[model samples]
Target: MTEANLTYVNGEPTLRFERRLRHPPAKVWRAVTDPAELKHWFPAAVETELRPGAPMRFVFPEEAVVDGAWDGEVLEVDEPKVFMFRWHQDVLRIEVIPDGDGCTLVFSQTIGGGRAGFLAAGRTAAGWDSCLDQLAARLDGTTVPARTDWVTPMAHYIEKFGLGDGTVTATTDGYELRFARDLVWRKPADTWPVLTRSLETGHVTKEEPPRVLEYEWSQGGTVRWEFVSDPKLGERVELTHTLPATLAELRPLALATWHHRLELFFAAATGGVDESWSEDRVAELVKHYA
Candidate 1:
């Protein structure tokens, strides 16, 4: 196993990284600071000491083979397990601990302040992330292809900036809401009417069987949509804000909505929601009923 985990905390724009090395402190230490070894995983450059209060210069020779270098200070350094530093306006923490048959290494950074702050933090974080992955591969005696020419999608990268608690909740005018249960619906002929009505009434704005469905809702001006899918069934539909108020008021409100919607939706195809209904099966019955 490669000795590292990298995570970008969404809300508070901070980088949290960790790695478990299969080697001892001595070997891990050398891999981190030895100029030759560091170059294997990091940018082509040179280094001085991993010590406290010392000015260490690591030049990305490749940058100078163009024209620049990043300079920083070594804030704290302890043999084998911990190293802390400040690099170009960011706080960097590195931790190495002895674990079972090897060592664990961790790197963390917190950077945020201004326009330059975002750019600097992002670049620094991604650069370190790629470099650390290289470090892990090297320690495990593996080879990694260098991605020097790669360009990251900025939108996708920027999306990582939002660190909202994964919980979805919204409140307005005494209505507090959250997602209850989400399901993907498939085209079961037994449920044709519901599907037909759903599509006809604009209840569904998008469709890709088993992929996604978007349902819209509006209550006294507040509006949002629930996304759903049933990948296994190859037909998935999402329920949006079309449920009656009585059902919407329930705790985990979405659950009640699903129960009510699914029942009505399938009733059109299966004569009832309790029985299994396939598209062909329902279609045959639907034609007879028609």
Candidate 2:
């Protein structure tokens, strides 16, 4: 299995994967194009005619399901050469080319999660990696891996694709941020401990169990945290900070500092090492979010 390459097609991020199969082009074509063969390795139960303008429905097995999916029209089919289709908001393309006596399977997908989806490139890539591995196993007549290790490949993709950085927006009232960190693996019953531990002191303005927590900041304004449910993790955090007019000039600093603090808190919760903070690191992040 080759490492995925991130490319852009019409300003959309595309994850491309290449696999060299020992089988010939005609043999590989059946595995990729035939529905019966695809059932062994393909992500979902693909149902559609082998022609363009045909309806496509990606039915997932209930127990091993992931997220929003299961419908599209077949885009193209060049018979034993190219197979392309739409899977929800994504455009997936599969190409089979002869290489010596064997063949090459080229798979690429155009991601479609909006801003959040852009940040989830690694997750998407890791998933396809697992699928391709299964395809290889089936072709080789070997037992497919029952469980794919997502964490190891995801970490590589995040760093390689620069998906760990969060985004900051300047609103009329103040600043809003959406983090791109992979904080989905571990979700605590009560996230308040992580919050209180991160910020230390703040008057509680709103509290709603393990879901929402609003705060009246000691420095002024409001800081709210929301724990959204995630499939892999119990929940993921979303933060909104409203700064007082007086703190307008300090918005960047506050956000940058919180970025570091949040990292510390996440590390603590996940039993990861507490790395020492650096002004240089904060300054660099502020430049991006400023």
Give the clashing pairs for model 2: none
Cα distance off (Å), candidate 2, residue 189? 8.3
- Give the TM-score of each candidate: 0.47, 0.74
Give the top-scoring candidate (TM-score): 2
Task: For candidate 2, write residues 1-290 as lDDT tens digits.
Answer: 68899999999999999999999888888898788999998877777788899987776675343433445888999988999998767889999999998988999999875655565677678878888998888888998657634555666787688665555677776666545454544554655566555565488888886667788767777777776765522345666677755667777777786676656555555444445678997898688658
Cα error, residue 64 of model 1, in Å, equals 4.1
Error of 1 at 276 (Å): 40
Per-model C-alpha lDDT, please?
0.50, 0.73
| Ten contiguous residues minimizing lDDT sum, candidate 1 | 177-186
